[model samples]
Target: MSSNAELHTLKQRTDNYAYVLRCRETGLCAVIDASEPDSVLELLARIDGRLSLILNTHHHPDHTAANPELVARTGAPVLAAPWSGHAGSGPDITLKDGDPIILGRLRGTVLATPGHTLSDLCFWFEADRLLFTGDTLFSMGCGRLFEGTARQMWASLTRLRALPADTLVLCGHDYTLGNIAFARSLDPHNAALLEWEATVRARKAVGALPPHPTLGLEARANPFLRADDPDIQKSLDMPGADPSDVFAEIRRRKDHFTA
Candidate 1:
């Protein structure tokens, strides 16, 4: 993306993450998944940001709880998936797959990735190689099948796996450490997974957030994203099984995972 476009990642309500995207040239800003109204408003005030848009990835409260306050405060329009259950006056602009979203000079495309929720939408800024994947995709894990099927989630992940290898994945939550544990359980010998776990632990030890992994790194390390890998399939004793099936089994195990 342009050097003029800046992104601020805000930690919210425990593990949730919200983001502020600002366009320097226009001084226009957009908040993605404003989970905490107070925090987001405080940041906007500090930065003197003129909020022009509020973007939501899903209807979950953790992602939309601040919609009403934000919309009322800034008069900014809310852009979200058609099925979004906003706490405010619904979405001002309902987006679908392939839709275009413009923030000043930056352009983004909406990807309908329904798995975590039937309404999950991911924003991809091709120029900047920044992908804001709400709850659909996580660091080393994928979201649970709350309102969609395993097949849907697997297909959604497959589409994301095709993005530019360098794309920076900004997910909704920071589950890196826990996810690393799960990945190791399945792919214990994966050098990439082991290395990533070490890096994440080191960051945590120093009180730093885990570094956002590039799409390429995710493809290599995230077991959920590698459901199609022959090695993973073999490890699961499901060699040659459909990738979606493998993905479903993994998700099931994750849902019941302890530690």
Candidate 2:
């Protein structure tokens, strides 16, 4: 596998994101999360026009709404967890944790991360050192605990945090602004976070988002990832509390956050 695999990000709706992974040498391509089939098809044409696989991070309609349509148009095999109801008539290939999906010379390893949904999965391209975190882990926060419990979510995040520090994370939505707002309410004195908020706000003001933050940067700026941090724990008045318990409180406050 030549390390020339390139990623292209597509925004569907207001906050949703769809990504395309393409091999620069072979022109082989894989589409991740088909939010809108039309938009994906258009981008496919622009990027070599060869769709070999459709990878869904979760069964949410926002992510898989275009799955069936895309399969119908391109005849590409869809790969997703069996529990994801939005995989249309089910995936052509049922993906499991630690399994790899190959496209040309590129390979994406599947990781089961059930939090927002029981079937949530993230795709990790180890060769490229990139991770496509569906909704479980975002830029500065994580997904809401819709179907999974707070403890489950905590474990899920812990697993992600253990990945290589330099790994680049591509998440499901554009919630950095709202996440930063909530983070500031707790870890106010974090210089890295304050600087990140200023930079993200400026980008938003100009209608552009800052380049996706890496795992190392998120570890510093994202409060959810820092649920056990001294300042965050102190702010919540839970000094020496369990990380999971601390995470639950942070999640509770984030749910009621205005911005």
Candidate 3:
């Protein structure tokens, strides 16, 4: 069966954020996170579809700054978590765990995968095999412990990893190269890290975008996710064999590394 739906992604480097557009051949379309309203509008204008809705992963300003303006422009419904405190006058739709939004030709299920923030929500498009991870799950790493616990974040990421192998991850930022750098420090012998870094550099040099909507299988090659690997545990001086613990310790190291 051929899908009439097509996914459009437009990224910006200023804050390393991205906005996604999902368009069905039925002249209807929806966007995920309007980080940059102007850029989003430009793309929307070019695409031959009706702007139907705006999907938000979290209440973070960087991710939602342009929501008001975009909503005004398109008169689309703003979908977010009930706890986000982001109810705009432009018609708010609060979503909870297990709540699915059925926009006629399009459908998306919401997951309360909090960790980066208490109100963080990730959306899973079963048909597209795409996960809008917001800031919780990054390219090679995960989000900071700003409003949630390491345990919570770990659990959230685990749930994401449990998805289908073909799922395409449309994360909030383009932190691939930077993440690979830290991955190398944590796992010096990881050939995958080296190769991934090389690929990132090549893309940047050519002024081309790195392959995003990263596949689930590729992330398993990431050291942050392979917390059970003996070499990774040894490098971090973490003695546990649990993947969750390994992931938590890696987060601490990354926080300290940045500090």
Candidate 4:
């Protein structure tokens, strides 16, 4: 099915991102990761949309700090994972992996990706070819295992990797430049990575939002997703190592990576 959803991207709170999704058919709207109420409210007003649902990817303050205010302002019900520890208004309807999210004619699927936080849930609007990854998968990087194990993180990433190559990735944070730097350090000879780095630099120089990379580009360029690649394993001096172990090592390197 093709998408009947209109996506509006809003940059909020420094590096964080909040998305507004509107169903074109029924005019129903939903906000993903309502991080900043003022910005989200302004956009909603500009778009003349009545917020129907406030979707939370995780319980992190940067991702959900405005949940209560948004709910109060728009009377929109919150939808989140059962374990989501949202600050004020709790989830009106809890979601799980494979659960369907309906916004008018647009349908999305909830993907349980518990790497950044055990409660992390990504929304995949297959018809639209959009994946809203909340800190679980970045452009050229993945989230650090703050509350979960490396193995768990790897497993979560694997699930995302299985998505369609053309799917556009919308991440929670704009850490693309830093992630690119890290990716280049590992895969210096990757033409795709090099080309992407130039594109990102150009966009950043113009103060534009980082380009939203496709899953196919990520599979070829992102070292985190390429943990099973022989080149990545060899670069880490862990040839023939388990993919999980390779992912763990990459995550470890990224944690301390300054450049």
Clashing pairs in 3: none
User: Candidate 1 or 2, higher lDDT?
Assistant: 1
RMSD of 2: 1.8
Query: Model 4 compared with the native: what TM-score?
Result: 0.96
Specify the poorest-scoring 10-residue window by lDDT in model 3.
Answer: 82-91
Off by over 4 Å in 2: 1-3, 84-87
For each candidate, give its TM-score against the true structure: 0.96, 0.94, 0.89, 0.96
Stretches of model 3 off by over 4 angstroms after superposition? 84-91, 213-215
Q: Please report, as a residue range, the 10-residue window in candidate 1 with the lowest summed lDDT.
A: 81-90
RMSD after CA superposition, every candidate: 1.4, 1.8, 2.5, 1.5
TM match of model 3 to true structure:
0.89
State the lDDT of candidate 2 residue by residue for 167-216, as single tens digits.
88899998887888888888777898888888888887897756677888
lDDT of 2 at 253: 94
Q: Assess each prediction's global lDDT (C-alpha) against the native.
A: 0.90, 0.85, 0.74, 0.89
RMSD of 3: 2.5
lDDT of 1 by residue, 1-259 (tens): 5697788889999999999998888878999997788888898888878899999998888888898889889999999987633444568899999999899988999999999988899999998889999988899998999899999999999999999999999999998889988988988888888888888889899988888888998999898998899998988999999999999999999999888
Least accurate stretch of 10 residues (summed lDDT) in model 2? 83-92
